[model samples]
Target: MFDISMAEWSQNAPARARLLLVGGLVALTGVLALVFSLREPGSIAIAEWWPAASAAVAAALCARKHERPYVAVGVVLLVFLGLLSGGRSLELSFLDSVGNAVEAWLVAAIIAARRQQLSLKTVADVGRLLVATVAGAAVAALCVATGAHLVGLDFAASFVPIAAAHALTIVCIVPLVIIPRLHFRVSTPPKTIAISGALVLSVLAAFYPGSPAPLTFLPVPILAWAALSQSMFTAVFQLIGVLGGISALTIFGGGPFAYVTGAVPGIAFLQLYSFTLAALALLIGAAAQERRVIERERLALASLVRGAFERGPNGFAVLQEAASNWFELIEINAAAPALVPDSFEHSAGQWRLQRASRLHEIISRLSAGTEQTFEWSAAPGAASTAQLTITVGHQPNGSRTVVLAITDLAPMREAQRKLEEQLARERAISNELRKLNQQKDDFVASVSHELRTPITSILGYAEDMRENHGVTADEESLEVIERNAMRLLAVVDDVLLISRRNSDTSEPPARRRIAVGRAIDQCVSDLGRFAASKSVEVHVKVAPDTYLYVPESDFARVLSNLVTNAIKFSVPGATVKITADTKGDEVMLEVEDSGRGISREDRDRIFDPFYRSPQAIRDGIPGTGLGLPISRDLVHSMGGSIGLKSVLGEGTCVEVRIPLVRPEATQ
Candidate 1:
C-alpha cells in the first residue's frame, strides 16, 4: 500500500491530486447517473437532469484547464456506462454522454473565459454563474436533440425539456458544491437554530399528507428569511434541505406536488419550484454577504477614525454655520473641553463679541472652502493665546461645517523670549569687551608716545659724544649706549604703530606710488648691521620697475619687518634673500631666510599679535612677537595678503602680494 503522506506524493500533489479527483469523479458520476436515470423509453430528453450532469460539471469546474481533457473523457465514459446500465441502447447512450460531457466543459469554459472565481459571493457572481449555466444548457440541449434526431427521435419536441432540465440541474447543484468550499464564519447558533427550525416546520407543513396544492409556496418565505438573516452557508444548506424534503415527499405520492394531475407534469412543476427556490436563496444570499462585508469594513474604518480623533493632542471642534453669521457648536473631541472650559454657547458668544471683525471675514470667506488661521485668547485681554485653524467644508445635504483646531502658542512664545534674552546678554558682553580693548590700546599709545622722546634724546646725545670725544678710552661704551638706545626706539616705534592701527581715530596714511626695488634696498640697508653681526649675508633681487600703490611709510615698515625677522632667525653665514617682481596685476615680494624654520604646528598663527613660536621661546630668541603682526596689518591696510611657507630645519619663505602700480598711471 502507498503512503499518501510520503514526500513523493506531497511533491507531486497537483498531478496526484488531479488523478485522484478524476478517479473519484468517475465513480461519483457513474453512481449518481445510475441512481437518478429514468428507465422510461420516452424520457430520453431528461438525461441531462440526472444527478450525474451536476457532478460532471462540478468536477470539470474543479479541474484546472490542463486536467480537463482527462476529466472530460472520464465524464463521457462514466455517463455512457451509467446510461447503458439504465437500459438505453449503445448508440443513444454514447450520444447522450457526449452531450453531457459537452455541457460540463462548456460551463467550465464560460466561467474561465469570464475570469470569475468559482464562488458566488455577490450579485455579479450570481449573474455570471447564471449566464454560464444558461449558455452551457442551451448548447448541450441542441447537441442532445441532434443526436436524438439522428436516432429518429423528434428534435423540436425534445430540445425544450433537455434545455430546461440541464439549466435547472446546474443552477440547483453547482452553488451547493462550490459555495461550501469557501471558508465562512459559522452563523451564530441561536439564529442558525431558529432559522433551521422554521425551515423544517415550513417544509413539513407544505409536504405533509393531504396538504393543499397552493401550500407548496409556504417554504418560500422561510428560504428568503434564511437568506437575509443567516450566513451564506446556512442559507444554502437550508435550501438543500427544502429541496430534499419536496422531492422525497412527492416521490412517495404524499406532498402537494404529488396532487398534480400527471406524473410528468408534477415532476416538471417540482423542478420549476426547486429552481425558483435555488435562485432566491443563492442571489439573496450573495447580496446579503456582500453587504455584510462592506458594513464590516465601514465599522472598522469608523473605529479607527474615532480613535485618532479622541487621542489626538490638538483640540478639535465641529461647528455648524448659521444664517446669523454665528457658529453653532455641534461636537467636540476629548481635548477641546480643556481649551474651552466654559459652556460652548457662552464661549461662542464671547468669541463673536471679542473677535467680531475677524469673525466677519471668516464668515464671508467660508463658502470658498479654504482653511484660515487666527490667534485667540481664552479670555479678552489675556496674555497667553491659542492658534485656531478653521477648515470649512459642506455636509452631504449642502450645509456648511467648520472644523476648528486649537494649538497653544504660549510655549513657543516663551522659547522665543528666552532666546532673545540670551542674545541680548551676548551682545552686551561683546560691546563691553570692545570698550576695554579700546582702553588698553589707548594706554599703550600714550606710554609709547611718552618713551619715544627720551629714547631719541639719548641716541642723539650718545652719537654727539662719540663724534666729539673720539679716541677716548670710553668710546666703546658710548657706542654700546647708542646701540641700546636705538633698539629701545625701535620697540617704542613698533608699539606706537600697533596702537595707531587699533585706534579708530587713526586713519591710513596716504598712498604713494613707490618703486619696489628701492624699498627692498632700503629694508636691506636698515638691517645691514644686524645681518652683519650674525654673519648672515643679505642678498636683494628686485625688478626696479615693479612699483606698488601703497603708503610709502607702510610699505617701508612691511619690508623692514620682514627683513628684520629673516635676519634674526638666520644661521650664521646663511644667506637672507629679498626678492620682488610684478606678476599679473600685483607685485610679489618674498623674503627667504636660511633659518631654523617655523614648524607646521606654529606656522598657522605666525602672524598673530604677541604669539611667539614654541621653537623661538625654546631657543631664547629675543623677539617681542610684534614684527609679523604689524607687517600683516600694514599689508592688509594696503589691500594685500601675506603668507609664509616653511619646512622645519630648512629655510622659511615669507611672501607678500600687493596691488602693483602701472607705469603709465604712476607717471
Candidate 2:
C-alpha cells in the first residue's frame, strides 16, 4: 500500500525532467482542445466542450507528476489559448478561461492532497476519481453559467450542457491518459485480448445507424465481460471506445438517441448511459484485481506449510477429536505412514494395541489438553528392545487436532544404561576404601593405648633410680632419659585422643555454662612451667564473667593446645598473649605469639592430622604434629570454630569463637 502511494513520476526523475514532462503534456492538451474546438459551429455564448476536456486530462497528468501549482498555472494558460484560438475576444476569453482553470485546479488539488496515484487497484481508488471529476465539473459549470448571464444569456440554458459535457469528458479521457502511464504492467493474455476485441466490435455493431433501439442493450454484457477478463486499463479503454462510437453515430443523426428531436436532450441521455456503464466497468475490474491478489497469497502460505511438514525428521500425525473422546486421523506426513498402516483408518484402537501401556498414558494426558511424552517399545520382551519416544501436543481449535511426534529412543536408552553401570562400580570402590581407612584408625588407637603404660613405667623407674642411688658422674644421662620418657608419653596420649575421636560414635559433651575467662586462666597456669622453661613471657587479657555454653573440658583442651603452641614457637624474650572477649552471643578467644610466622604454602595443611610446617621441622621443635588437628576437632565438637592467620617474619595469631551463654538463659 505504501509503495503504491509513493509511485509518482518525480520519484525517479529529477525536478527539471518532471517540469518538462508537465509542460509537454499541457501544450499537447491545449493544441488538441484548439483543434477540436474549431470543429464546433456554436457561438461563443455556448460552453466549449474541448477546453474543459483538455484541462481535465492535463490536470490529472500534472497531479501524477506531483506538481499541483504547475497544473493550475498551465491549465489556465492552456484554456486561455484554447478560447483565443476559437476566436473569442480578450476580456470575455479571460473570464471563461479562468473558470475552466479553477475546475482543473480543483481536480489536481484533491488528488495530490489525498496522495492518490492514478492507478485503479481497488474500488475506492476509482470511486475517489469519479467524485473529484463530478465536483470539479459542477464548480466549472457554475462559473460558466455566471459568465454567460453577464453576457445577457440564461444561466439554466448554459449550465446544464456545460456541466454534463465536462463530466463525461473527464470520466472518459483522464483515466485513458493517466491509468496507462501509472500502471506500467498493462499486458493481457491473448485470449483476453481476443475477447475484448470481439466485445468492442459487438458494441460498435449494436450502435450502427440502422440498428433497432433494443440492440443498444447488447453492449452491457460485453462491457461486463471486458471488466472481468481484461486489465483495468484495458477495460477502461473499451468503455471509452463504446462511448465514442455512440457519440459519433448520434452526431451524424443515425443512432437510436438521434431519433429524439433536440440535440441537447439526445446527448444528455447518451452521457447518462455512458456514465453508468463506466462506473460498473471500473467496479468489476477493481474487484477482479483484489481477488487475484488474495488467491496468490493463499497459495503461498499453503506451500510454506506443506514444505515445513514434509522436511520434519520425526513421524508426525494430526488427529481430529471426535465424539466419545475418539480421535480421527486428519493429516499425516511421510514418516508417519510407516509407523501406522492403513492411513485412512479413523480409530486409535489399531495403533494403541501394538504400543505399551506407557504410550496410552501419554495419549490420555494429551487428550485432556496437557502436553505429554513417554517411551514405547515395539518388541517389549526382546533382549534389545526397539523403543520409540512419543510426544503428544493438543492444538486448540473447534476440531481439537492432536499432533503426535514419534522418535526412536533405542540408542539413547543404551547410552543411559552404560552410564548407570559405571556409577555403580565407582560407588563400590569408594565403600571399600572407606572400610580400609577405619581399620587403619583402629590399629593406631590400639598401639597408642598399649605404649602409654610402658612409657609411664619407664619414666617412674628413671626418676626412682636417680633419687635412690648415691651421686654419680652418669646423673646427667639418667635425667635426659627421664625427660625423653615424659615427651613420649605426651605423644602417645595425642595419638590415642585423635584415634578415639575418629572411630568412636560418642554423644557430644554436655553443654555447661562456665566462665570462659576462668578457662583461659587455667590453661595459662598449666602451661606456665613450659613458658618459664623457654623464657617466654605469657600475658592473659580475658574479660571478666565472659561465659560460654560448651563443655568445660573441651574448652580447656582447646585453649591449652593453642597456648602451648604459641609458647613453643616464640623467641626467648617474646610474649605469648592470650585474650578472650564476648561479641554478639559468641566468645572470641585469641592467642598471639611474637615468633617466626608460618609461610603462605604451609597454612592450608596446618590443621591436618600429623602435618607440620617445614620451618617447624627445620627448627627441630620438640613436639608431635597432632596439636592443631586435635584442637580443631575439640572446638568443632563443642559448637565452635578455630582459624589461624599469620604473615612471614611478622607473627602468628590463632582465633577461636564459641557460642556464649547469656546470664538470663542460665537462670
Candidate 3:
C-alpha cells in the first residue's frame, strides 16, 4: 500500500528535514549529557538505544500528524512496548481495560467530528460531535481508574476526587471556549458584554473547588441551547466551551504523570487523557467555521460581480484567442441587447475579419488599462453627425468592454435640411423686398425732383410779390398759404429720408470699438432737437468705460431708432432714459420710455417687420412700422442682439447688447 501517512500533505506532520534535524540534535544532546554526567570523553552510546530512538521518532510523527487513527495506533504501540517491558507477568483485565479502550474511541471520535465539520457544509451532520463530548468525558474518567487499578493503586478513592477536579475544570474553561463560537447577529455592545460575562463566570468556576464527582453532563445545558439556537456558529462555540473549559480545568490540575506516571497527585494523571479530548474537539470546530466562511464569501462575491456585469448599461463579451478565435457575448443590458444580442463565431452579414483593426488595438490597450477613453467618428455610411466612445473596465484579458454610444441623426439632420430650405425662401423674399424698396426710393426721388422746382417757383413768386409789387393783401390767406406749403415740404423731406436712406451706403459702415457711454451720449445729442420740439427730454444713464466692437454706423442706427421711438411714444415732459453697461465683454444699452407701455402679447410681435402695437395704432402714431425690426437687423449684423420688455401700464425698455472686441469676447 502507498504510504499515505508519509505524504507531504499529511496533517500537522513535520517534514523530513525537521525530523532529521531533531534526530541529530537529540543525538548530540545525549552525548553531551553522558559526557557531563560521567565526566568522561566518549562517543554517543547509540548501539544500545536504536529501538527506543526509533520508537520515539515514530511517536513524534504520530502525534504531530494529529490524525485520530494514527494517534490510536501510536497509543497501542506504546502499550505494546509496556507489555514487552513487563513480559507475560504484566497482566491486564479485559473489563478494567475497557475504560481505556472507550476513552481512546471517544478521543478519536471528537477529532474525526471536528475534521468533518471543517470539510462539510450542513450542520445536520454533527452526529459524531453529539456523541464525542459526554461520552468522551465519561470514558476518560473510566480510563484513569482502570490505569490506577493496573498500577495496584486505590482506584475508587482517587477517581472521585480527580473526577470532581475534572468537573470543576470543565465548568471553568468550557465557557471561555463557547463564548467565542456564538456568532449571534446582535449589536456589538450587547455581544461584548455577554461574552465577557460568560468568561468571568467560567474562570471563577474553574478556580472553585468541589463539584459533582463526574463532569460528564456539565456541558449538556449549553449544548442544548446551542442546538435550539439553530446557529452553526453557536453550536460550534458551545462545543468549544464544553471541550476547552473542561480540558483547561483538567490539564491545569496536578498532572505530569497524567495517565502514565501516576506518581503525582491523582488530579494530574486524570487530566492528561481528558484534556487531550478537549483540544482535538475544539480544533475541529474552528476549522469547520473557517471553511464555511470561505465558501460563503466566495459565493457572495460571485453574485455581486455577476449583478454588475449583467445590469450595466453596455454589452460585454469575453473573446478567446484560440483556434476558435471568437468573441463570446457574455452579458447584455436591456437597452443595448437588441443591437449586439449575441456574438457570431464567424462573420455573417455586415461583419468582416479585419487583419488590422484600429478598433481592436484600441480595445486591447484599454483592457490592459493603458487607456481610459477612445473617441472616433462614425464609419462611412454610418450616422455622420454622431461619434462613438469606448470606455474600458478594470479587468485585464478578454475583449475589452466596447461601449458604443451612437447618437441618432434623424432629428438634427432633418432640422438642418429644413433650415436650408427656409433660408433659400427667406433669401428670395428678401430680394423681392429690396426691389420694392428700390422702386419706392426711385418714386420718392422722382416726386421730390419734380415737386422741388414748382415749390421753389411758388415760394419765389410769393416773396417777389411781397417785395416788388406792394399790393394790399388778406393777412389770413397769406399766412395760410405759407404755413401749408412749409408743412408739405417738411412731410416730403421725411418721406425721402425713409425711402432712400435705408439702402444708401455711407462710408462702408465705419467699423470701430466705440464706448457704449459715448455711443448713448451721441444718440442723445443727435436727437436733442427732436425731443425739444416735443417738449420731452432724453436722459442718458451710462457707466463709463463700457466698450463694444461693432460697425459704428449700424450701432448708431440702432441707438437712433430706439431713442426716436422712445421720444415719439412718450408724453410731453416724460423723460426717456438711455442707459449703457457692460456684462463681461458685451455692451448692454437700454432706452426706456415713461409713455404707455406695450402689451404682453404685442411685445414679441412688435419686433416683426411692418408690425405696430395696438396702442400706437389707437393713437394714430405716424411711423413706418419698420423701426424695431430694422434695429434688430442692424444689431445682429454687428454681432449683437436687441429685445423689448414692458408692462401694460409701465413704460417700455428696448435693450441692445453688442459684442466687445475679439480679445475681450466671453464666449
For each of the candidates, give the backbone clash count: 0, 0, 10
lDDT of each: 0.76, 0.70, 0.51
RMSD values for the candidates in order, in angstroms, are 11.1, 11.1, 23.7
Candidate 1, residues 1-667, lDDT tens digits: the string is: 0122121222245877866765776679877776665556434535425667777887887777777787789888888888778776677778778878888888877765655345566788788778888888787778777877777888886776777778877887777645633244646888888988988888878887767555777889889989988777668777878888778877777676676785256666777778778888889988887887788779889999888987877778777766545666676776665654442424533322122444435544677378888777656687646677878897676677888787767678889999999999999999999999999999998899899988888888887888787777878798788778877887889999988887888876887788888878877787777788889998888886788778899899888888888988988889988888888999899999989998887888887888999878888877788999999888877778899999889989999997775245433
- What are the runs in model 3 whose C-alpha is more than 4 Å off? 1-326, 331-362, 365-367, 370-386, 396-400, 408-415, 474-476, 506-667
Comparison by TM-score, 2 against 3, better one = 2
Candidate 1 residue pairs that clash: none
Best lDDT goes to which candidate? 1
Task: Give the Å shift of residue 218 in candidate 3.
Answer: 24
In the range 276-331, model 2's lDDT, one tens digit per residue, is 78778888877876666566668778889888877765577766666434565566
TM-score of 1: 0.55
Q: What C-alpha lDDT, on a 0 to 100 scale, does residue 456 get in candidate 1?
A: 86
Report the lDDT tens digits of candidate 3 across residue range 1-667.
Answer: 0112221222334657554543443343233223332332221111101122222222232233344344444344444333333321233322222333344445334534434222222233233433443464465456555555665657675565434433333322322312223232422455544653454355335332343344443344334433333333444444445445544554455112223344455444334434443344434444554555566678889999878765654434443332233223343344332222222223453232232554445444544334343323335355454333555443354444444443334456699999999999999999999889787888887898777667767666666666676556644455466545654554564454455556565233557777778877887897776689678988887888777777777677778889989998999889898888888877778889989888878876887767887778889876767777777866766777788888777798888887675333422
**Number of the top-ranking candidate, with TM-score as the measure:** 2
The alpha-carbon lDDT assigned to residue 495 of candidate 3 equals: 51
